[model samples]
Target: MRKLLFFVIIFGFSSSIQAQKYSKEVLDSMYSITQQTKLELTKPKSIKLMAVGDIMMGTNFPNDSYLPPEGKGPFDNVNVILTQADILFGNLEGTLTDEGENAKRCSDPSKCYSFRSPESYGKYLEETGFDVMSIANNHIGDFGAIGIKNTSKTLEKHNIAYAGIFAQPSTIFEKNGITYGFCAFAPNKDCIKIHNLTNAKKIVEELKQKADIVIVSFHGGAEGLKHTHVTRKTERFYGEDRGNVYKFAHTMIDAGADVIIGHGPHVSRAFEVYKNKFIAYSLGNFCTYSRFNLDGIKGYAPIAEIEIDLDGNFMKGKLHSAKQIDEVYPFIDEKKRALKEIKKLTQEDFPESKLIFDEDGSFTQQKE
Candidate 1:
C-alpha cells in the first residue's frame, strides 16, 4: 500500500487514483507537467562576469613611495560597477607580501622592478567584490616562492579564489546555485605554462565535467603598445615564448571553456566570439600604481562585463572605459579611449568575428 501511494504521488495522480488507475485527462496533465519541468531545468540562465587587466595597487618592495595615497581608494571610482557583476576578476600583477627576496637577478638595482604590496591590501579586493583573480603573470614570481606563498595565503584569508600557479592550477566554486571552474596559465616560472595546449585542454575538459561553467585566464602575449594587435602566432618577448593567443583561445573553447580572459600585455588587444564563447585577448593595465608606464594607450584601463548563459555561451557584453593619468588611481574616462582602442584592434585583427561593438561600448554577437 505504501509503495502504491508513492507511485501515485510520483506521478502527480489524484488521491482517488491511488490504485494506479488514471483517466486520460489525468495522464495528459501528468505528461504536460513532466515536460514543463524538463523545459525549466534545461533552460539557459546567464551570469554577469566583469574582468580587468593587471592590478597592482602599490608595491612596497623598492619603497613605500610607490604606494597610493588613498590606499584602497584606488578602486573607489569603479567599485559600484564592479560589485554589479556576479564575478569580478583581475590579474594580480605582483605579490601581496610586505617583504621578500627579489627573484629576478638584476645587475643594476635602480632598473629592477619588483612589486610587493602589503598583505592587508587583500581586503580592498574583497571589499571591491573581486570574486577571483589570476596570479599567473610575470610579476607574480618577482619575489620568488615566498611571494607566491604569501599572496596565496592572503587571498585565501580574504575568501578570494586565485589560480595559475602549479600548486593550485584550477579552482571550482559555487555562486547562486551555479558552479564555476576557473584556471589560469602564464609563460613565467612556477606558473602553469600557457604554451602546453595538451595540459590546458585536459584541465578544461575535467573542469567542464564537474562545473556548470568554465573560465580560462592566461597571461600571454608580448607587452607594450607596439604589440597591441594579435599576430595569430606565437609571440616572443625578450626571447620568451608568450604562446599563440589566437590558437590558445580557440583550443580552450573546443575543450569546453566558456570564457577566456587574457592579460600580460600592458595594453588592451582584441575581442573575439568563437564556438558561442567570448574571448578578450588582453585587458591591459587596470589599476597599477607607481612604476608602470601610463602613456598613450598604456594608461587605458578597460572593464569588460560579459553576460554568458549556463552553457557558457556569449549573450551580450559592454566595455567601460577608465584611465590612469599621473595619479596612481584610475578614473572614469570621459573620452572612452579604452572602447576606441578595443574597437580598432578587434576590427583589424578579427574582422570575421561575430562580435559587434557600438560607439557606447555595448556589444553583442551577430545572429546566425
Candidate 2:
C-alpha cells in the first residue's frame, strides 16, 4: 500500500503543470520593459547572477587558504568572490555534514576524493551574498541518501538555499521574484547516482510558470576531456548512462528556461545559442583539489556572471576565466592568460561559435 501510494503521489504532481508558451516578441518586449528592472508587474529591481563549475571540497587535498585547516572550515575566500554578486551560484560537489556510515567516501583516505567539507562552510556562503547553491552534481549524494539529507540540513540550518539534491521539491527554489530550479544527473552509480527524470522535468516545467526567470543547472557529461562535447543522443561516461546533455538542456529551454548552466564535464564545453536561449555546455571545475588527468586546456575555469534585467530577462554578462594550477593546497586565483586561453579554446570548440575578448581576463559576447 505504501509503495502504491508513492506512485500515486508522483502521478498527481506530474499531471499538474501549465507551461507558458512564449513568443519572441512578447519575451523581447518583456525583456525591454524590464531591461534594468523598472517593471512593477514582474521586476526584481536588480538581479546579479554568478556561476562557477564544481566546488569539490575534498579532504584529500587539504589546504589552508582555499579550505579550512581542520575543524569547521572557513569559507572566507569563497565568500569574498561571491559577495560581489546579488545572487551567487555554484555546484557544491559533496555532502556538507559528517553523517551516515552506510556509504563511506572511499577506502583509501588519500587519493580518495569524496568531498566532505565542514557544514560551517554554509555560514560563509550565506554571508558572502550567495542566494543559492546548486547541489546537482555527481557528488551531491556521495555518501548516499544520508549525505544528501545531511547536506540539505546543513545548508538550511545556516540559511543557505540549495536545490537539485532533494527528491522533488527538495531541489527546487523560487525566490527574488524569480523561479529558479536545478537538477543533478549522473552516469556513475558508485558516487552520486541519480535515477529520476520525471522529478527533474516536473520541477523545470512547474518553475517555468511560477517564476519570472528559470535557471536550470545540469551536472553531467564526460570529465577531463577537452570539450567533452554534447551529442544529441544519450551520452555514456564509461558505458554508464549520462543523459544526452544537448537534449537535456534544449528540452529545458523549450519548456521556458531562461538560462541553462551545465557543469560535469570537468573541462569546459562550447557555449551555443539554441532556440534563442543560451546554453553553457559545461563550466568545468570551479574549485577542485586534484588536477589529475587534466591536460593543458582542461584545467581552465571561468567565473560566469549572467545579468538579468529588472524583469528577469537575459541581458549580458562577462566571463572571468580562472585557473587552479596547484593540485593540492590551492587558492582560487584569476589568471589573465588562462582567460585568454580559454576564450580561444572555446571558439575552437565551436568553430561556428562567436567570442569576444577583453583585457584583464574578461570577455563579453560579440553576438550573444
RMSD per candidate (Å) reads 6.5, 14.2
Each prediction's number of clashing residue pairs: 0, 2
Those runs of model 2 whose alpha carbons end farther than 4 Å from true positions after fitting are 1-46, 58-67, 70-81, 102-109, 169-179, 188-199, 226-228, 231-233, 290-298, 310-313, 327-334, 351-355, 360-368
Candidate 2, poorest ten consecutive residues by summed lDDT: 59-68
lDDT of 2 by residue, 1-368 (tens): 99999999887766543223335667888888776465355545657788887776543233233353455333444445556776677777776766654354556645455666666666655665666677866666556787778788888787666666436343455665455554444444532233355555776777766666677777777666543556656766666676778777767777667778888877777666555456777887766655234455556666777666644455566666666554532235455544665566667655554555567544444663
lDDT of 2 at 281: 78
Model 1's alpha-carbon lDDT is: 0.90
TM-score of each: 0.87, 0.73
TM-score of 1: 0.87
Minimum summed lDDT over a 10-residue window in model 1 is located at 13-22
Residue lDDT tens for model 1, 38-157: 876765477899999999988876667778876357699888788898989999999999668888888975578988999989989988889889999889889988999999999999
